[model samples]
Target chain A: AQSVTQLDSQVPVFEEAPVELRCNYSSSVSVYLFWYVQYPNQGLQLLLKYLSGSTLVKGINGFEAEFNKSQTSFHLRKPSVHISDTAEYFCAVSPQGINSGYSTLTFGKGTMLLVSP
Target chain B: DAGITQSPRHKVTETGTPVTLRCHQTENHRYMYWYRQDPGHGLRLIHYSYGVKDTDKGEVSDGYSVSRSKTEDFLLTLESATSSQTSVYFCAISGRGIEQYFGPGTRLTVT
Candidate 1:
């Protein structure tokens, strides 16, 4: 079984300031990491994903994440945040399943990013 | 906005009543999923389907059932609504490369 843990429940940041959201996961086998954003009253949008290769993956809206295999961490980072970035961020993991039909996603509790101008 | 739509965006039902939610995806994806979101719990998968008539239960699937009759349609049914089942439900379609596109969500309140 795979599980994801989001350390912070909420994070507040001023516009143009840097922000980091921490995420960790537990899995015995290789897994795929993903970051999704949910705006108010909207569905989730994929921000980025780390499937293989590069440890540092860049995503849309100037967001990036570093995948640390040894530490079992995938932390999202943004050098400068904007008011539009205020939303709920979720970290998820998809562990390799027995077959292609058995894959599942395990999500964290989510971290609400409140960017104030 | 991956051409996914969930019908009856908001619904209110009493306990013991049966309710069904519909998810329609135009992407023609091979995989579809049903998930429920509650306060502080994030999103939990209720069920998923890999192909038509092929379904499997997830971590939280005791009170719910899902059916995929067509490639673009997945239906979620609650056998008997309960207070604990009051939450926002989202339908997702899996795209290429392990990415999922979610619906707008349906808010169901079981009083």
Candidate 2:
């Protein structure tokens, strides 16, 4: 079984400052990683995903995440943040090579990014 | 934007009352799922459907039940609601890839 852990409960950053949100997962088999962002009273939006090939995955809203297989970590980073970026971020993982019909994603508790001016 | 919609976006009910939430999708995806979100717990899967009339329980499925009658509609039923069941419920549809598209969510309150 696979599980995810978002190390930080909340991260605060001023506008134009860089920010990083840490995530770790545990799985016996290979897995696919994803990042999703949720705004206030809204549903989750796909930020990015790492299926294979590259460790660094680019996402929407100028966000990116690096997957470190050795450490079982996928950390999201952004060089500059905006006040609109204040929202909750979730990290999820799915067992690799699984069919979409039976695949399920295990999600982390989430990290709230607070971007202020 | 996978053309998913959740009905009764906000609801309030008394304890022990039965409630049902509806999810409709236009994408005609094969997989659908129901999840509840609370503070400190990002999202916990309650149930999922791989096809019409085919459903399975998830990590937190004790107090919830789900049904998918048609390709586009998935229904979640809470028989005898409790205060602990109050939460924001989200419905999702899986794409050809491993990614899932989410609905706007329904905020349920049990009084």
Candidate 3:
């Protein structure tokens, strides 16, 4: 019964500009959050994850996301983006503890980030 | 890719024909999963295996079957291919957490 919602279907940004991709989840219990990126004709790669401890988690490629427990949001942000950063990003969530024994991840629809010069 | 590979990277079959996709891994991970990606749907899990011969159905498992006979290989089969099944399929593996490494993906089409 867990679900993820990415508000933006597409985000267009110029090079060197800051960008944020919004993600929200609905889960009754504690959950693990993750962000993944997929370039053209390639598989998804992990950008970052929020397991515990830190509220602001930094990830690969100069990306960071903050896990706001009260708002049920984990939005990804970057100070600046490059043309190579153009890719489809996904937000995923999995419940904590024995309930997630299989470790199944529930993913949002995805947000396509189009970075241009 | 985490040493994961999917065979028949691009396949096209008829509606009534049977199709099977193979996923091979070299990392010897304990968990393997099969997911399908469609435009606007992101990725939906079809099946997963915790160990050899120990498989479980995922959220979108209808009309699909999976088999994991060995730790290194997982196979997904469609009894009858349909247009709705025309999408990219990805294989993922995880050792201990929810962090999964994905394969290059196989593009399947039913004409």
Top model number, DockQ? 2
Which candidate, 2 or 3, would have the higher TM-score against the true structure? 2
| Model 1 residue B46 lDDT score | 96
Better of 1 and 3 by lDDT: 3
How many clashes show up in model 2? 0
What docking class should model 3 receive? medium
Clashing pairs in 2: none
Q: State how far residue B100 of model 3 sits from its true place (Å).
A: 0.7
Query: Which digits, one per residue and each the tens of the lDDT, describe model 1 over residues A1-117?
Result: 899999999999999999999999999999989999999998899999998899999999999999999999999999999999999999999986445533588999999999998
Q: Candidate 2's residue-wise lDDT over A8-89, tens digit each?
A: 9999899999999999999999999999999999999999999999899999999999999999999999999999999999
Please write out the lDDT profile of model 3 over residues B66-107, one tens digit for every residue: 999999999999999899999999999988666889999999
lDDT of 2 by residue, B1-111 (tens): 789999999999999999999999999899999999999988999999999999999999998999998999999999999999999999999968789889999999999
**Residue B31 shift from truth in candidate 3, angstroms:** 0.7
| The candidate that achieves the highest TM-score relative to the unseen native structure | 2
After best superposition, candidate 3 residue A102: deviation in angstroms?
Answer: 4.3
Each prediction's whole-model lDDT (CA): 0.93, 0.95, 0.94
* Deviation from truth (RMSD, Å), model 3: 1.2
DockQ of each: 0.60, 0.72, 0.62
